[model samples]
Target: MESKSSPCRPQDLGKFEVTQRDGAARLGKFFTKHGVLNTPALLPVVNPNILTVEPRSLWDEFGFRALITNSYVIWKNEILRERATKEGIHELLDFPGVIMTDSGTFQSYVYGDVEVSVEEIVKFQATIGVDIGTMLDVFGRPDMTRKEIEDAVRITAERATKSLQVADTKIMLNGPIQGGLHQDLRAKSAKMMAESEYQQSNFSIHPIGGIVPLMESQRYHDLSEIILSSSSELPANRPMHIFGCGHPMLFPMCIALGADLFDSAAYALFAKDGRLLSEEGTYRIESMVEWPTQSSHISPYTPAQVRAMSKPERTSLLARHNLEVTQRELARCREAVRNGSIWGMAERRSHSSPHLREAFLGIIRERTDPNEPSAKRIRSIIRSTDPIRPSSEPLSEDLLHRPHIIHANSLLVQRWRPPGSWHDGSIGAPSRVVVMKGGEPPWRASYGSTVQRVLKEDPRTVVMIDSLIGLVPYSLEDLSPWCRVEGSNIHPIGTKDADYSVDLESMGLGGIPVLVLTPEGSEYEQDKSILAWIDRCSFVDKLSVLCAVSPAIGCEITDEIRVRRSNTNRPVNVYNGEMHLFSPRLNDGGISLALHGAKLIHEAMKSARDNDEGSTITTTK
Candidate 1:
């Protein structure tokens, strides 16, 4: 006889794998039929009964790639059950992305009983084309006795076999860790579940549930420790789902600690409570000074306007707002991961949740201090329980100490220490020439080609200073070739608030003779300040002002400074209004333009450094 076929073949089976893990923290991805999911992601919770936001809208408007709904709820409702069974959860929700199903454990905790069996719910989830399914688990509340918690864990593990037996599809199963608030019991549950044959064959996620109440009650330290212990034991390959972590505040720290998946109704819950999710935490509409965002989504109505509307209307709009914020935060997390800055993002987020930050600080301090005993206690506890099965390579110390990079709040003193280069020696003090150049310009449209060519050959630290209109900083390299291709049409690299005057001295752009490229007919104040800074440098050194002039807007160094330069300690090499013009980098990479690229970039560097110019400083407030 032919061997029985595995439900999940190597080709069809999808799962998450940790690429980089720092202690309990990790960076990973989840693969599904729909697409690969970037991990440390929050799966928005959906209620079929409520239908607050359509799943498709969640994907489109909020960028939610995955969402979770209750398989038990669908099974109990005949209409939903029939539709789900016939077409699948994706068809029912009209969502093309991954759809996960909860197994009714939370509802049972709330209502005291549930109608469906564990096997029945798993079957329903599989039949509904769910991407992932949860095995019905007995939830032991935070106040439960140790015996009660142990009993719950045992029962859940016992039922795991039956649930897997009935799950006919390859839908991933969630094996929830239940131990109420007892750390040892939690570890015991994790160990017992991992040891079960059903666990080895079917479970794909180890979610720590029954802790929503704990988190809701502000038992955060308990929640933190529980998560640390429970997650530490689970197989690193499988994603760790936080069953009810919906609030944005918990995302960074949780993701940092190897929690790959999360689901929550916080957006809707907070919306109903008249609270908006902000980076700083939830806020009431009535207390706001100004609008948090300027997009059409929130710009349609001000917070005061929304506050005056009927409660239902206000709630719906606020729910949308909260969801948008949640999605944006998740996007930020993903971007940080891509740029190798996940820890940095987490550190910044810690500031918003002081308690969470305190919890982390406590962990770091305890681990770092020689006198702390928690290390021994923690090691003993984990070793004794041995929840996570020992894998080939254990988490390493080097991984744990990885630096957390964050945006500098003030003028950041980032040491330019690249492997072995300009970052090394203390060169002579800064020159006094300051250059003011137009950014996001007519030059970009008309002369973008030239900019790219110049940048390709330019050795100067080509800093693309911002006028403080956006939230983040950017570099000319980021805008490069793309800006040249799209020219004058290039959108601002950052939003409007990212404005910061070019502080040449601080930026290492100071006191070398300078080239100021101003766009003709542009009067942006920061651009003018750059020119003024250049004038200051002229007092001590030479200042060169280069303009990218359009025929329509005549290009001229309309003003010049004469040589009664200042006696600042810095060298004064200034080329006062020594103007030059260049076209944009050409679309086609021809020899002539390439030659021009080398020449212009070289001349700019020479003029900026050759003269003993005065120091120049530009400020944007």
Candidate 2:
């Protein structure tokens, strides 16, 4: 027999890498012998006999890196079990990517009982050469009391000890969280699983199981609490799976709260009823006026084709569409995580289903209320409250340093209801602000130089460049408020000089002096090009000006200066006076650049206004 640990083996599978941790929610990559499974991913449930979509075909079409199947189903059938054992589960499924197997807990729930022993199932799964396997935990029914739940947990933990004794394949074990509705029981179960040496080098994932009833009942509060209590107690490194939760509507909340993998038989389940999954919501096959796709089951098929097609073919094709939809939602979620907008995506997805939205709101309500000692006791007694949402707050202030804020989606400016004094006036027109971080010169240091040049030369500019992107033209009609606020790094608009063609006049700031607030650099020339450009613009000379004075230098262009230096034609004024650059130490999360920029611009404007130069301030767009 080949050694599992032997290096240079052609058969060895690899591992997972933690990329970003946002509170309990993590973004990671799980490396398999075939390909990397991106974390916070959904693994669609596959039944071998059912063959909703062929596993290999799923990988080819959808880029689904991993999937979960039932070992018990395959094990019970002689032909299926024999073939899987002899040729390996991967070969049986014909899937090269990672495969996970369930120990028939869910089947047991549906069928009243399952006769398989814990050790027998684990050994069967390992021998099949499965990448990950589940231990047969004693699942708790919804009717189980605290004592009964405790017994189930204790028994499951005990079974884990005996099950792994015969297991040798470094095949990952799913140490499922199984404490029914009891929060303390859930926590205790998780802690026990975390400590037991039985779990020492064995388990790959720890999924929260037996919650299908809770989800179906919309008992979101209980579901949330169970996950929170269990996940917090488990080891940080291992992936956490939310068993049987494949609905696109539920992913944002679950993913936000730190779940890594999810599985659902929803595509098959929904397809059986002639329903199609979509980001907006599920659409019924009968009610569709138009197919979401150009060709759907409802169309391109003659009544003859529909009547002639076998039930299995129709079901399989519908199941394929539903699975495709599920994969699309998962892809959107992964992108949202990469862009640091998972919560926002969740907010939108909540609207997909009313029940889903209720569950989310329940979670949000529980999350907002500060926990009191009495409330904790009440929580223990009711067992009905929403899960305390894991904090969505960035892990640290420094981590909150997001790069840029482009309109990745529509909700950008509308959703950015600023905290504290950053509020807009009551019924204020929408505004955009481009916020960047750091203190170095825009040229030598960041993209500040490029931005400064754009704002300086453009007429009717309302560019307020600072730690926050805050640009307010007289109106908000032309540009998306979100688009105005440039996110952290300003990538050059591909091949298009957007800076020149942006048409500031149409944006309602045609005559306003552009606000080119930036962090003062160590040297005078840090912003010299911008200043020189502004000085030379024919249109700028006609506009009134005010700069928030920065200690660095220069007042807003003044009238006394306009008459005296009119003949000089310096086109650029080099304010050689010493100026302080915005540099908060690396450890501090403060935006020294933004603070200093705002102050300097504000002071310059103040100085200009004090000198009695008339500046028009109009509100009507």
Tell me, what's the RMSD of every candidate? 17.0, 14.9
Candidate 1 at residue 45, lDDT?
84
Q: Number of clashes in every candidate structure?
A: 55, 33
N/CA/C clash count, model 2: 33
Candidate 1's C-alpha runs over 4 A off are 1-12, 19-24, 287-289, 292-296, 338-340, 365-621
Give candidate 2 regions above 4 Å deviation. Answer: 1-14, 21-23, 292-309, 368-621
The CA lDDT at 526 in model 1 is 30
List lDDT for all candidates, in order.
0.57, 0.57
* Model 1: per-residue Cα lDDT over 1-621, one tens digit each: 211112333564667766755434567767776666767778888888887778888877766778999988888899998998998888898887778889889999888789887777787788788988888999989888888888898999899778777764467777898887776677777776666555457576788888899778656666666776676467767788888987777777676555778889988888788878876677777787678653356777877788788988888788888888777777666565554445546666666766776765654443333432333333432223211111111122222333321112111223221111111122333332222234553233333333333333342223243322221112221221222222222343433332234444454444455444333443332332333332332211111211221111110121233222246322122233442222222221101122433354455445545652212211110
Question: lDDT, candidate 1, residue 130?
Answer: 90
Model 2, CA-based lDDT: 0.57
Q: Please write out the lDDT profile of model 2 over residues 44-81, one tens digit for every residue.
A: 88899988788877778767778899999999999999
